[model samples]
Target: MKNFILALIVGLLVSACSIQRSAITGDKRAYGYSWEQEKQIGKEADEQIKQHFGVYDNVALQQYVNKIGQEMLAVSHMQREDTPATYKDTEFFFRLLDSPVVNAFALPGGYIYVTRGLLSHLDNEAQLAVVLGHEIGHVAARHASQRAFIQQMSQIALVGGAIAGQHFLGIPGGDLLGIGGMAAQVIFLSYSREDERESDRLGVEYASMQRYKSAEGAQFFVSLERMSAQSGQSIPNWQSTHPDPAERATSIPELAEEWRAIGYEQTIVNTDQYMGMLNNMIYGDNPREGFTRSGTYYHPEMKFQFSYPEGWHVINQRSLVAVVNNDQNAVSIMTLDNESAGAEASVNVFLNQDGITTTGKSGITNRGLQAFQAEATGQTQDGVALKFYLYSIEYDGMIYRFINYTTVDNYGTYGPRFKEITSGFRQLTDSGILNIQPVRLQAVKTTRSGTFRSFLPANLENLVINVTPEDIAIMNQVGLDERIESGTWIKIPR
Candidate 1:
């Protein structure tokens, strides 16, 4: 018994020693995940991420982001001389998400993602490097591992394993509470404030080492501030998932100055080069995928058309589309049903799910498509009573389903609108609409000096998708009336 106790004590000591302090934060942590476990989790989450948000689908752009990321990663603590051999061999992946949401995040084991929405706002390559470097810092400092350790201590599931399955793992089938579905949200949970700050400092450090003008990165925060104000958000996103934009604007410049004082004087802006790359890039939402015009939603590739209730907000995600009412009281989501069965069978499968009670028989659509419509009642996870209006339609060999819901009391007011939208589905046969290409940012040079607004097209609203002269001004980092020098290049969507 004495010998066995001695052996156990030695094993525990070895295990404890394996948990090392962070190189950047100096925080001692006994990470819940082994190096292999961390890699495995990230790999699994990465697969789901690709299915959810999709890869951006531009090879040159992908290569450009990876090139900058790998350069910064070489200088990060993950590749430092003192880094453990176990960590040194870990490969880092930098992916550009096709999403238009202005967001960036890192997964536990060296996977980083940035949305095109965030990329479009950046003025130069230096800013992009800083953003990539910040994500790299998260991996280098092992923030996710530390968070996982705390989650384990609290006995809270990091993310339930059941979330890996279909049917949104338990979320009501039609809600947009978790956009890009729930699995994407699991990998993108906000980082701690301290972790964000540490990553900020590391971002500045890595960008400076690369001879980039790190202060240029702070300008992106100005855009974020403008976006928050315009959207009427109570708190800016930076404050929630990242350090406050105002705070970062101050700190990043200060760090950049310090790096300059240390003799790294070749701070390159490379503005023109970056602007050249932005030429012909998709400026905002890619309307080719799906877009709403005059209360109608059109998917060019799918060649389908539908209409939602007037004045409702439309959220088009990679996997599904959601139409939400003004009062946040009702949501109607359209998504593809995985089952290959006919419309009636698909509706039967959905209604048969646990906790949902069907109240009516399925009916066919009068618009030529074979459709199944049913009314049902179900309770939310919070036990709130909800009235559901579901429709499954057969279109082009695929089963498309709409799950529309509202409170039991409000269903009468919302039901007709739901019925209108579900019945509105039809094959889109408009050639001009079908061939509508997404607006691409075209580089143009001024023939003569004038205010930035002078160069804008007369029918700017028609040319661009939901863009204004003011938006173009902000995108170019100038005032709308700011005078442009002759021969200077600027970007405009075409």
Candidate 2:
């Protein structure tokens, strides 16, 4: 998220004189950044995105998505004959993020990303084409640049922090310590309703040109609608911005029909191929990164464990884990200091920051690990006074820093809770917790024709956390009572 912070700051610092013609309509329009500047911004943001949400590790799946994206691009406005020369040859980058959120989005330039969670919900390649085409439409239409033109830069910054707080800390304006940047930008990049509708039209047009069954795209929206209704909230990264999944479910087919009337023969629906690609794919949360149980957090991969106060929320990402208080005023963060050689060296970096005044510093030991502890007071960028209790532990040749902080006025109330959590940090030793594996999609062929529910294992809950027959049905794009033919491949969590 720090990269997101830098991206926002860099965006704010850009010159405002830049303007450019629309890539899709060829009409002269005002833009926040020149076309060349957009490319540079996207290149910088792309690096941060990869770091924030690690690329999905499957090489074959990555190539498959890229191939589809390139095909969609060929038919998009960016590649059309009327497109300006400056944009006609813009290279597009399509990436599958390892995150489990159902989302697909485009950066200001030609950077596009789809999450593994979205892939898990898709039933066919044509649906994927439409999703990729939808994102490509955003880039082709210069939606982000247009938004930047109409929005106040300061408002965008506030929106970034608000999204980070809400998503990570479960509070609308909670200040998440270290995990606030690029990921927040993802939610911050949500388009207007008009932009979304335009993207939908462009998506159908591009997918239709490629002869995909563009109408199949509607089914994915149906899945999204069901997911939203079941969760009682919009799906993260997607529905948050692209609202009205149920409404889109109706319009998508109408758009496809419009294309058919124009002589586009949409017929492709590579279900088997898509299903084959999904076999053995990871589903739900990847617990190897970290998981919480009975108030203790454990990282099997990192081989560490810690305890947070009961009722505090935990947001665990590939880079770090943040624990937030119920009131969202206090936060404790844990992250690696890869560059620092030892605990004391890491502590120095924290103490040297501007506006920070150290009140106490000492060498200490925690759970048999060498560590340095420090107490400091400082004011935030917004001039909010705060107190900090920091720790840097050296264990197995790596420095793990725990940053605990709260508003100066509330420090007395939450200070003990912070100390208790950091002091509880220890090496993970339980064999069962260390060996837990992530649930994965198992592509199973039905032995006999039956309702989709009948094909699921009786111990469905045991196979995956918080999953149900209805959830699996929605994932397979079928109904719980729908009869599934024998020998047909369907995904089951295992």
Candidate 3:
């Protein structure tokens, strides 16, 4: 019995040691996720990510970005011969997410993502390399695993309050926690400020080692700062999960100078190559998925239209579309349920859910669409009381559900608005709205020297890209008053 007890203790110690040493940064006090476990976690999270935000649908651009990412990874920390076999064997995936939100991030086990929004903002290839390297650094340093371990150790319950915290942190699945449950939020958890700083450091190191002019990466941060200021946001959504852009812009150039001091003379900054790649890139939101115009939500592919409450905020995610009142005391969500054969079946499913108390008669909507409406009260898993008006309508061969909910106390005030929106749903038949294309960036050469604003075409705002001279200045990495030399190439939205 004594010998068996000793053996058990020895095995436990070995396991703990393995977990500590698994960190790619060689920190023995790091998290408990083994390389294999990290990979598994990333794999599962990657699927959820793909489901929530699809891959950007450009094959050639995807390949081009992947080629650059592959080159960077070959020189990253994980690619070293001294890296642990488990970690070294893990394959890194670079994906361009189809989101208009400018952002770049990574998941555990070598999964890295950059949004097309982020790509469109980049000024040069070296900046792109630095961004990719920063995300890779997060994966290599086991930051997400560390965060998961911290969450586990802290036993942070991902309830409504926690979901709100995640939302304010700018991670995905903020409002989605209530819709799809907590699984979606888990995969998109944010990193700590320290983790972001370390990744930034790693980014400079890796990009500089690859002989890229890493200082050019600072221009992206400048754009971020300008964007935040323009939006009147104290911190941009992307920076909420990462670090302060102003701080990053200040420090990145200094870090680049240090890297250059190591005797690397021929650093490459392929600005023309990068700008040419982004010449026709989509600038802002893609209307193909869904878009709002004159307070109405239109889905071109789904061929449906609905009016949301005026002044309400809307979040259009891939999995769902949601609108919440300015007070945030009420929310209206739209989703599809293909499994339900008809409207009555969809209503029945909602009524059958646990804790739901159906309080009104369910019947057809006023428009003669196969539909039913029900007033229901329910409690979330956290036991928060909720009042809901659920509308299930069968439209275009699918069951479309409109769930409007509020706290029990606020239901009376929000009920009329909810009813108005739910009743406003109908099939769309407008060809012009359906065929509208997204705004794209057009690279044009300067005909004569002038201020940046002078080069902008008169109908810039009327086009899909709604931006100002200040925005154009930031994109071109020049001042608004800076004179443009003749024949200089610049990007203008068209």
Q: Write the per-residue lDDT of candidate 3 for residues 352-447, one digit (tens) a residue.
A: 987899999467765667888889998765676888899989887888888888878888999999988888889888998778788788876788
Ranking by lDDT: 2, 1, 3
When 2 and 3 are scored with TM-score, the better candidate is: 2
Cα lDDT tens digits, model 2, 283-308, are: 98888879998899999988899999
* Span of ten consecutive residues with least summed lDDT in model 3: 163-172
What TM-score does structure 2 among the candidates reach?
A: 0.92
> What is the full ranking by TM-score, best candidate first?
2, 3, 1
> Each candidate's lDDT (Cα)?
0.78, 0.84, 0.77
Candidate 3 achieves a global lDDT of: 0.77
Better of 1 and 3 by lDDT: 1
**Candidate closer to the true structure by lDDT (higher is better), 1 or 2:** 2
1-494: candidate 1 lDDT, tens digit per residue: 99998777555544533376666655566775666776777888788778667898788888888998998999888888887777789999999988766778788778999887677778788999999999898888777777766655554544433221323314533234333332443453447999888889999999999899999888887777666666667232354656767788889999999999998774687777777766777778887889988999999989999988888988787788888788768888888987648888878887999999999966686468899989999987878899999889999989998888888999999999999888899999999889988887777767899999998878776863888877777666667898999988788777
Model 3 segments beyond 4 Å from truth? 1-18, 22-27, 158-188, 235-237, 240-243, 365-368
Q: How many clashes show up per model? A: 0, 2, 0
Q: How close is every model to the real structure, measured as TM-score? A: 0.85, 0.92, 0.88
Model 1 Cα shift for residue 306 (angstroms): 1.6
As a whole number from 0 to 100, the lDDT of residue 415 in candidate 1 is 95
Worst 10 residues of 2 by lDDT: 168-177
Best by TM-score: 2
